[model samples]
Target: MPHPPPLGDSAGQPGRSNRVLGRRGCHLPILPQQDGPAAPLPASPGDAKLQRAKEALRLAGHPGDPQSLEAVGLMLDKLAKENQDIRLMQAELRVILILPFLSLAPQAQKEELETLLRKSEENARLTEALQRETASLQAAQTELRLLREKLQGLGEAGLQRHRRVCPAGGAGTGPQGQVPAHYEGLAAALSTFFGSNGTFAHDRLSFVDFLDEVEDALEELAELLGVSKEDVDNFEEMALTQLEAAPWGR
Candidate 1:
């Protein structure tokens, strides 16, 4: 058997360079750049070797079968495929504490991978739920702001009506000082109905400052009359005044 080629004949290049395999000096065999890195083939340990392979039938060579070259190429292709699968798998996975996965049992590895998957799914669900809750809170805040603005508007409107209805004076007056005929008649009739009590006297000129002043005055008058609770019209004047002057809660 022939010995392996010399490390160098006269050059500084790392591996043998010769015309037999082109100036791509260190590479085993020149093929295409697509397979992977063009590397030197591994040496066979002993009896198994390289130089003694069968050559392609049409070419001039030796002791192996016709399928040898094609078989070696297919093996390299399988190796390249395995390298690609490793790259793809690593993209989605990460090892904790930089530990090598191969050191753990196969079942332990499976459990670790499943735990990662379930945690990732739960994190996604929680993120989506938090976003929805945040949106609902923002909507409720907007509605509350609008309601507060509406309530403020109503309060301002009521205040404006009060100022218009009750101006800065002890009495109320509508337009000119003279009363209309029917309105004067109504006042005179009310005066005749109440008759000379003087407190309830309604005339062409008299007016109340507060809206509830007349009703309050009437209640005072009824209390002074010693009127029965159910029949206000029937009363003893002396008994009513004495009761009104008595200390309350006695």
Candidate 2:
């Protein structure tokens, strides 16, 4: 019969027995922590180093610094040509910084920038249009003001001339060889009702209407002058026939 196995051993025999115990099975070993002080982390990469170098140059305030006095003398000799290089470099750096911001900026900020540009363009257009409109309105106002001033300067004799030249209402006379105050008031009212241009076109139609309204006034004037309404009507008919013969009447 086989002997019993020892504790922590499986049939303690020799090398062949250790193989039977499975000590050489696929098991991973635990690595030890590094000994002594740790090595410092590697320096920043080339790009970062370059950036730092540029920053240091800027801080040093020696942008025009050269590799040697000979290089400096050469740059000084071609200073005007070298000056444009500094401006070009600045422009290139601005573009580099601006490009990343443009790419990474929020969508809303981009839209707002577009909206601001559009609004500025629209505002400029509107401002120009308003300036033109204002000039036109000012010119029109000036013309109207001048016309009103001319009208205000007219005397009674001037008004009589106006009535004779542009008559809508009849030029009936009152007592003592004077134009009736009512006739002047009526003519002014008619002139105001129909503007300067409209007055001539609407004269006959407006006069017929005015005659009907001031019939009583006309009758009173006729009685004062000892003339009959029939006589006045006959005179009006004859005048109408003559006016209807004109080209405007067509």
Candidate 3:
């Protein structure tokens, strides 16, 4: 009834107050601690550092671990198989592409190609030989033409001289006429020269052989005529020219 003598008045009241405080004290809630048999977290900071050190050591020219070696071998084997497959595909493609050409090329075509090559080589050789022969023939022809022209010129000059020295007179002219005597003698000698005993005595002498004999005889006649060699040469050339101009000779 006195209000309990004022609550905080005595020293012995401290124990009673402590007990009240304990009853109303604040405390932290206790979490359940994860223990063994539970799934662990990822490696901690210190464990990660140790793992990195081990990786660095392994990378510094160290032998790979068994797992890494096995994985690498498997990768290399896969690459090798892939390479082989690619090579096989390439070979197959080549075969497919080339087979048609090979089949389409006839045996005869191959032979003809070889033959053409041989013929081309032969033709080259023959062409060189022909060129040499043609050049030689050309030179010979040039020399022959020059000789013919020289002979022709000399014959013309001789004929002119003979006409001056031995002028033929009229029909009644005597044997003393220089032209008449020379022609008569030449005709007689030619007839005798062409007789059976002559060099051109064959029944059917070639025109060339006949002419050669005639030219020889004319040479002798020119010497006997006491005329220049040019005169004889000119007379022979005139006879040959007349023969060549004859229709029968042509």
Candidate 4:
């Protein structure tokens, strides 16, 4: 994309120095007040001669061919609507500016004021609906946020439950029923050999039965002494080969 010419580069440009920024503001014509139902007066967006002068240098851009007519029609409709809006405003303002001078009874004026207020409220129906929709969306978002938090809490609780369920079995309580650190550590290490995820490659069934015996012997050893099984890098050290020669039994 090409960059716009710099302000300094346009120093010698004829129109650049003369160009005025912002609007000159609108002028409301002073006309004799005519009493009647409010109706917009004939209005134009700008001077036709000025518009034509500007258009001479650069004619209006348009959609090419077939769709151009439809586009033009839509644009004309928008312009017409905007022009009608000006007339409506003029009529309303004329009525409002003359209201104070109208020689009407206070009761009549009060009734008219009430009527206008009622009309204004009626026109605000769409705004009311928008407000209701916004409130409902906020309620739904709040409910969604609460459900997400609840789901997160449930996930954390499930994780805690999973942690409590020992893969190698027996979870004890406090004091005398507390699990020995060595027993916990050894059981955690041996867990893979007891389940479907076990890495045991041979005599798995016999190995599982042997593990049950080991558990019993290990429990007794924990009750008698503070020590537990160690040096378990090889299967031989844990008596994995012998049917009954277990480390805990020793």
TM-score of each: 0.31, 0.30, 0.30, 0.25
TM-score of 3: 0.30
lDDT of 2 at 11: 50
What value of lDDT does candidate 1 attain over all alpha carbons?
A: 0.49
Kindly provide the TM-score of model 4 when superposed on the true structure, using C-alpha atoms: 0.25
Model 4, span 47-124: residue lDDT tens: 663464454323335435545555556556766997999999999999998887665658888889889999999879
lDDT of each: 0.49, 0.56, 0.63, 0.55
Instruction: Give the distance in Å from residue 57's predicted Cα in candidate 2 to where it truly belongs.
Output: 32
Expressed as tens digits, the lDDT of each residue in 1-250 for candidate 2 is: 8863542334554322322223664434445558899898767666664665555545456545554444444445655665788999999999998998898999999999999999999999999999999999999999999998865664444545534533445355322223433445545554543554543455356665654654554465545444445644543343333334223453
Residue-wise lDDT of candidate 3 within 147-169, one digit each (tens)? 99987886677667566656767
Error of 4 at 35 (Å): 55
Better of 1 and 3 by TM-score: 1
lDDT of 4 at 96: 97
Candidate that would win on lDDT? 3
Q: How much does each candidate deviate from the true structure in C-alpha RMSD?
A: 21.4, 23.5, 24.0, 27.9
Cα-lDDT of candidate 4: 0.55
